[model samples]
Target chain A: MSDNQSSGPLVWLGTVLATCITLYLFQGILWLVVPILLSIILYYVTEPLVYRLTHHGWSRESAAGLVMGGLVLLLLAITAVTLPRFASKVTTWNEQKIISNYVQHGADFVESTLRTVEKYVPFIDEYMMSKARDNANWDEQLAKWAADNSSHTIMGLLHWIPSLLLIPYLTYFILVDGSQFKRFLVRAIPNAYFEKSLLLLHRIDDQVRRYFQGLMALTVIDAACLGIGLKLMGISGAFVLGLVIAVLSWIPYVGSIVGCLLVVLVAATDYASQTWMTYGAVALFLGVRLLDDFVFMPMTIGRSLQIHPVVTVLMIFVGGAVSGISGLLLVMPVLGVMMVLGQILGQLATNDRLTARYQFRKALLRARAQKGLEA
Target chain B: MLFSLGKKKNPRLAQLKGVSLFNDLKLSQLRIVNSLLHERNYLESELIFDQGDEGQALYIVASGKVRTHRDNQPEDKFVEFGPGDFFGELALLEDAPRSTSARAVEDTVLLALFRTEFLALLELHSSIGSMISYALARDLSRKLRKAIVSNENPTNL
Candidate 1:
């Protein structure tokens, strides 16, 4: 919640350059990065409980172990209770070819809409609609794009599963030994820069904590809004659907589209006799999305990770030009963190007193190291 | 000195136990606390910190001596700290400017316990944190009482 301190222009330039390069690299080693990202989230999610246990007189190891142990037990219990029922339902659904039925229902809605549109405007039916269509080049581009993207989604999920399984193990160590690792890193900083480094680290840690906490609050609000609206509108399992969509929205742009499309599909199939229900569902989704952008977002995530509207807009375009989709999605959070790092580094670079002390410490240390080794 | 507890073979841990702030911590906890400290050396008469500098650490004299006095006021003296003694304890509790400047009275090695790391220790291991906090509070109480008594009798000096 603390506003990031001001830094020099050089720092801002460095921050942008660093963010672009990091986003570019993330596109390559996504396998490693994905699990690390998930683990960090899981770490943040469970850290407060561990801290609570430590406050009650447990050592870090015991507290972390107990917390993670309870988590594993809860997960296993959920799996044990749900997996058999899920398997049975999936088998029954597959026999009915429910997926194709849903697709058919969606197609029916599209066809009816088209027919209605044709009534209002003649030459809109299939026969003369071909005359209104563009050319071979556009069709070819659409076909090529579909072919390129079609198989990757399934393959990408498969590729990430094994890595995703590493989240719990990684998160556990981060909970238990994270402080020790921090100490190890701190030990490497020379004493001249030590206090400043620690201060910066504390500030960064607080910022990150607030950011994640805000994210969780957003998820709860979004789920409650969507769930209650859909339930009131007579959708079955609406709360669960809303929860899934809210969680999916955590992944940024791609997730939002997929989640919206999924809800539209469910609404279409579930109320095949009432095409109006599907229309209402779509309308509801858009309204929630609008509110998310204009209100909920500012109240939650935006409050913690504040950026100037102008800089955010500019960096978005720059991010798109440099690294494409991932950059566009990640630039904001990366900028948030980079702003803090730059502020601290800028302060260090400009502090003549600290620089003098650093030089003295280094010279003194070097002389001590070389004292008996001289020829 | 008699209550000081640590294995004699590990001199660094032993030295940490000698400091009142860390005296009550177990050997294992002391090691954890010890790892958070940064070591620095200062030549005789070298400035450790300025009067107005943002205080971020409590500096404990590991060897030699240190003097605290106001900047540019030769007659204004606060206190002198020798080996096993610490100055700048207030920095651990909050972010504030130093009330007095510190300089090495002799070639000195200091173990600096920074606020951020110490606070992390407080979160992760409260017993170690509470022990040190108690020591700091007790020391501050003593200083306050002394100041009050001194004010009551100006000739006590």
Candidate 2:
């Protein structure tokens, strides 16, 4: 009975130890984790289709192959259609007239704003005036930063191509074999806890699947809203930028801020003279944020995770500190899984039947030990 | 001998048809149900599940025999179940503790349909879900009626 009482804490301690070990190991192979995570996400995305096809008498292998093949062709078509157009846009964007004009106008707007501030508060005008004069080449600075980041981004993508190529292959296997793997795991569990363990696993699977599918829906809707909003405001490359921001929004707090800054900068650069358009762009972004917070998220995701806001913020920071971007993206889902496991385990600990079984098992073990000693 | 290899024909589909829970399902629905089943082999005297363990799956005896007994009751007060007989139906409806322990009376082959898989199937095909749920309810009602009748006239046994 005493042993049964102590088992829960011991299990929790072991879990903590295992997690620490995993974190330590994960840091060294951070690069490999991306494709694996993407494959898992892709598996979830494509799994339903595989099951649906199998229901129509197609074997699992054939269904998985067909789905993955279609995915590959779709990706190829998108790349072939978009790459040349994107390259031409990049060329036009780099032109001196387009970039320099936008930058000069941005600087002038800032200068005017500072002058207005100086008018209201005379004490800081001299200091602000000095800073504004020194910041006259802000356009050139902006261009330099853009050039540096773009080059870095291109190089990073090129390096990532090999890993990215593995996604479909990994996804194919996962779709085909995921059920078998789950059954194999279930079979490995001891008979005593088989049902409880299976229930816990299923609960986790259902919740995670819902959370991810909801998240995907949210991202797509956000991208469409942002893209249409920007295009109506006459912004170029609006769809592409919207898509980028939508993807970034997966990173919780940091993502929204970064996305906002990106929209503001691009709007300021493209429609510099029309300050009202810039304000409109900001308004559009805020409106979308409001829609996300109030409508889309609630409808799609609901309160599935049930995480406290404070805990979420803390986990985001901890994840960021540990694994950078990937950690930020993954922390919420990991926390959700942990929450499910904790809830199930807590229930098991309090379950009268389970507690009694634990005590019985303990007694049986002790009796066996006593017999061994006598022998 | 309970886990002996059977003929080339897939026994699972045939066995599923005999189970009352799947009685109303169409051919296509039966196939879907068949896809979700997981088969296990148990030796004679092997414990299938102990009384008081949480139940999460409905098990159908594909071959051999099984006996269910309650630990608190006299040893003779137990039921023997044979091929095509299903138990743990309540597990399919909810996560509940088993009321009696189940063990293989001989080498047994059982087909288990887990609650999670069944729920997933229900989400995919409402018609099949309705059929199975209805069958389950009817089966439970019949059992309750039989038990009540027996309790009213104990000499019937």
Evaluated on chain B only, what are the TM-scores of all the candidate structures, in order? 0.88, 0.87
Interface RMSD to the true structure, each candidate: 6.1, 5.9
User: TM-score for all predictions?
Assistant: 0.78, 0.77
Superposed model 2: Cα runs more than 4 Å off: A1-24, A51-59, A87-146, A345-375, B1-35, B39-55, B61-66, B70-75, B82-84, B93-110, B119-149, B152-157
How many residue pairs in model 1 have overlapping backbones? 0
Name the fnat for model 1: 0.34
Model 1 residue A295 lDDT score: 96
Q: List runs of model 1 lying over 4 Å from the truth.
A: A1-4, A77-152, A231-240, A251-258, A290-302, A309-333, A362-375, B1-10, B24-47, B75-78, B105-107, B116-131, B144-157
Q: In lDDT terms, which candidate is top? A: 1
The most accurate candidate by DockQ is 1
Clashes of 2: 0
CA lDDT, candidate 2, residue A369:
67
lDDT of 1 by residue, A1-375 (tens): 122457667898998888878878777876777678767777887888888887787876788888888887998898799879866765655456555555556655665666667778885566655443433444345434544543454356557767877888888889876756776667677655666777778777877876787788788898999899889889877988888888877655555787787777788888988888988988898888889888998888775656566777788777677778666666666677677777777877777887898787678767778998967
In order, what are the TM-scores of chain A for the candidates?
0.76, 0.81
For each candidate, the DockQ is 0.32, 0.25
